[model samples]
Target: MPAKQRSFAQTLNAVAWSFIGLRRRRDFDEDVGALNPFYVIAGGVLGCALFIALLLGAVRLAVA
Candidate 1:
């Protein structure tokens, strides 16, 4: 049997781009360049949230 495929979020991050009509490769590059700050802020926020959740879970497990 073939291995299972990964989830969409694991394989690609094009959901937002698709909604904005940036489906083409050139359009994607242009959009990315124009939205560099948004991307940076999003990445930072996601990273921090994930880190905090992991830390809290670890502490809870240890205390329990």
Candidate 2:
């Protein structure tokens, strides 16, 4: 989400940054215009799934 459409990796990186709950205003502005909405949505879903899986795994270990 620079001056051009972001690639898959770039999209994921952006998604990751968002997940962390902090973003630079300059980057946010760039992403708002240049990042694909679909890719962002898909990346968010994938990230959430992975986070849930890791959380469940940790809980299982702790319980065991």
Candidate 3:
């Protein structure tokens, strides 16, 4: 029998989970619980900015 290969979406999900510390289950949960609302808001804003930048880059390439 052969092992199944991970899909691109699964790989990306793993990467994002690791980045947010979910790889360390207990610590990640505790850290998330301890996080302040302001920090959460800041992270949301940063994520939005990053997403917007990617979208803009794609649009520019399409226009070119």
Pick out the ten consecutive residues of candidate 3 with the lowest summed lDDT: 1-10
Task: Write one digit per residue (lDDT tens) for candidate 2, span 39-63.
Answer: 9999999999999999999999999
Taking the tens digit of each residue's C-alpha lDDT, what string does model 1 give over 4-36? 433434223443445445678875554453444
* Comparing 1 and 3 on lDDT, the stronger one: 3
Clashing pairs in 1: none
Clashes of each: 0, 0, 0
- Per-residue error for 5 in candidate 2, Å, reads 0.6
Off by over 4 Å in 1: 1-35
> For residues 1-64, could you state the per-residue lDDT of candidate 3 as single tens digits?
4334444444444445655656667644554445454545555566568778989999999999
C-alpha lDDT values of all predictions: 0.55, 0.90, 0.58
lDDT of 2 at 25: 84
Each prediction's TM-score against the native?
0.46, 0.90, 0.51
List ranges where model 2 is wrong by over 4 Å: none
| lDDT at residue 7 of model 1 (Cα atoms) | 41
TM-score of 2: 0.90
- What 10-residue stretch in candidate 2 is worst by lDDT? 1-10
lDDT, model 1, position 46? 66
